[model samples]
Target: MKRPLVSAAVVATMLSSAVATQTYADDALVVSSKIDTEGSVLGQMILQRLSAAGLEVEDRLQLGGTSIVREALLNGEIDIYPEYTGNGAFFHDMTDSPVWHDAQQAYDTVKAKDAELGLEWLTPASANNTYAISVRGDVARENGLETLEDMASFINDGGDYKLAASTDFVESAFALPAFEAAYGFSLDDDDLLVLSGGNTAATMRAAAQQTSGVNSAMTYGTDGGLQALDLVVMTDTKGVQPVYQPAPVIRRAALDNHPEIAAALAPVFESLSLETLQRLNGDVAVNGLDPAKVAADYLATLED
Candidate 1:
């Protein structure tokens, strides 16, 4: 069969497209995270796992806070990062919706919504790093307080209950007020010692030391200092706050280029239960271990 002549311009255009595609495929994946102990830990895990899978990864861990890292992902400056599923409420302006309070529902909602933006939400860790009220070990043991409901009854029964927390937790309607409304208990002005910043470390310390008569303090579910400081996180049985499960969110383009990324990370995240994450975070925050070392040590255990 006789072939028709092709224009030189068309041939050149085809070659250009091929080169562009190849360049994109060759580009290093940029991983980033928020500026926090958990972020650093999660980011390091992502970096190490992807590298182990034989993919070139650029480290941008501890990039910034939620806004900064999230924006970077959206802007294509970062290929992947750890994000909280519950934050989807604010991300999509559905904070009033009740879906964020459920773990699976929250993850499903965000995964579907972000799909429109060409993002992929991978499997989330079992841990829900949401706001929690932790009490001293002695107080919890003495009063048999394991959940927020128990604390509410304790407070109503004139039990000595003083909480050390950040001003934001005190004033935010979605925090202490939400707990009060859901659990049917209230904390008086005298019952709180409002700190300046929202660092749970300080709050946990105050409760551990009984500073200013604080037997309780505001904390997160995965805070490392909880166990070491002898503080017990009160379970949110009422599910007042959104479920903030950590998950790896990646740009669809990057994921398409490296489909193995999902499988490589699934087991790691699956192993991260609430207690496991607490222990990992403690290694860094309490033990002062390097985040990379902590992540490497944890990942090594999976091989065994």
Candidate 2:
């Protein structure tokens, strides 16, 4: 079933009412976030679990980019949502230095910055959202190409491999340029197929489905399909990409009011290994299950 679209004015009204209700209820938190099929899978899970914990959840959601969510948090329109640490480093303008390798350092940097915005970043789930490169299982098995170091040798020795990458990968400071500089393998401009905006999942699935264009793609490290399509992630033997973990960020007022909220959701973080998260992502993103239900069921499993 589709959720009704709530206008900005309606959300504003709801926020006001929720704020007033908070005085009486004392456990209310307004979660504002994107409603896209991709983001909703993750957002709805957190929202649903938080609501089930007796927090009065006002889902005054919207379909927008991360910038919109960030602005909403700053304006006090929303109290909490899941956020990525690298997004804080790059998009939020914290530091130019690559700090993704150190999870604790990244958390500290983001926490310090969020304080300026009157926000607090809770402990992050154990998932790194770093950029990755993947090759078809067959190619990997046949050539023993399992890591970026292997791929660099293959490419340098004139291996017949092509790559499909997003425009972002082509331009991101941490994506392709870093790979080239670290490995000393320059792709013939013709060897790369640039997708206007699609990321790794689309390219990976397409590669699995067909043996045309490119044999590899640029992807996120924790993408669910890497194993599903029998694709092998070429290890960043040189360690180029940065770490990105998903975390809950809340308004300071909300945290102060309901200090136990983090503990309630802490179990979800405790069991979220890379493989576990990938299976969950496959269930919601690939198999098309309701994210809220998946999140709820997974949370329930934690109690078992």
Candidate 3:
């Protein structure tokens, strides 16, 4: 026999003394996310899509960081959340494997491994959103530097060059060193303006306005500030960084009961190209718009 449908009010009443309705620690298909802007927006998008699909949901948005949310899901406190494909390497200790650098291999490895723990990895979005290097539009246009290989040639020819980058990018295996290894170009300490502890925005802004003679900045492919700052993301043709594509992950038990969840999200994620996500992120990150509003606007576009 089917258990009677539980009303939101009744569920709220039960969990009120324990936790907020959004953070209800029950088996009602609770959806959750981390405390970052990307997490909030993507989690909200998943939550709203489930609700719109007529699936009863508990909106547990911004619950915590990746570890916290992963713990909640595994402990049966939440049913589903967004996760990156590349994270599985560390989560499962597969960093030594080459799968993380390849999209399909990473997806396959993660899905297969997580299934053993009763988690279902759903379809992922197309947007990679991984690390990239951006040069000022004029700099790229003048030198035809559209990809890492182009940058290599320009640097090899001793073209004027200076890069503003985060300290991590300077030392990380998948960053500058990898670029040099793949593209056959090298930049000594003299060529880099190491921000030490700076964020992408600072580096991007420096390059955008040509402050300090910085001609390039490190960025993510989906950074909202790219087009606005007239910067072009250099293509990672050699696949240096690990692919960080987003996917909806659900508890196998929850999926068994509400399979429609996958169908509803498939279309949404499919439509979310890298360009689309950047604009949506810009609304929240750069334009100071509310995350819910940005999600609503994008959903409206889908309906139209």
Candidate 4:
């Protein structure tokens, strides 16, 4: 059988395309995360899981804060990283919207919105690491407080209520003020011990020690020290705070290049419930274990 004649230019173009495709496929994916304990843990999990799937990956974990990491992803400086579904409200300037309070709705909204920017939101963990108000275990039990509403009522009835929190949490309109408005209670200057930085560890510790009469602290739902420090997280019964479920957000091009990325990570994230994430974060933040080692140990449990 005779093959049709091909011109030299056509052959050269075909060869160039093949080389480009090959080079693209051979490129190493850069995985990064925010400089936080949970970020490092999630980043390590992604790096290890992708490597196990026989894909080339670069470790850029613990890169920086949310803004820095998010910008890197947008500018193609990073290929993938862990992010919260709730932050989409801020990213898209929809903080006033109520969708962020719902897990599936927030995920869907962000996933759909980011698609236009060539980003993909993978399956999120069931954990909601949102802004939380935690009280000392003894205080919670004594006051019969289980939720923010209960705390509000307690405070309205002249209960002792001092909160240790970061300046950002204390001042942010969307944070403390939103809670106050939703739950119908306010904290005066004497009612708060505002810290300098937004480290939940410091706040939780202060509350644990009753620093400046602070029996309560601003915390995230999945804070590691909650259980270890005997702090009980007051439930946000009215869904006042946005849901911050961690999930891997990737550049669409990277996923297209490696379709297996989604399947490789789905079960891993699916296993991370609120309690599971708190325990994992505690393993590092409380137990002083290495984040990489903690990720490795957890991943090992999922093996067949």
The C-alpha lDDT values of all candidates are 0.88, 0.72, 0.82, 0.88
User: Deviation in angstroms for 192 in model 1?
Assistant: 1.9
For candidate 2, what is the lDDT? 0.72
Off by over 4 Å in 4: 1-25, 142-144
Candidates ranked by TM-score, best first?
3, 1, 4, 2
Candidate 1's residue-wise lDDT over 24-123, tens digit each?
A: 2338999888888999999999999999989999888886667666766786778999999988886787878999898989999999999999999998
- Point out where model 1 deviates above 4 Å: 1-26
TM-score of 2: 0.80
**Order of the predicted models by lDDT, top scorer first:** 1, 4, 3, 2
Model 4 per-residue lDDT at 47 = 97
**Residue range 195-259, candidate 4, lDDT tens digits:** 99888889999999999999999999998888888888888988888888999999999999999
User: What TM-score do all the candidates reach, one by one?
Assistant: 0.88, 0.80, 0.89, 0.84
Number of the top-ranking candidate, with TM-score as the measure: 3
Q: What lDDT tens digits, residue by residue, belong to model 2 across residues 1-304?
A: 1112346576566556545654332355777556544355557766877877877887655435565566578777678877777776654554467665577777788888789878998878777657888888888888999789898888898888888888888887767989988987888777787778755667786668754568888777667677777777787766576666777788999999888878876777656665676677777767778777777787778768
- The global Cα lDDT (0 to 1) of model 1 is 0.88
> Which window of 10 residues has the lowest lDDT sum in candidate 3?
1-10
- Looking at model 4, report the run of 10 residues with the lowest lDDT sum: 1-10
Clash totals for all models, in order? 0, 1, 0, 0
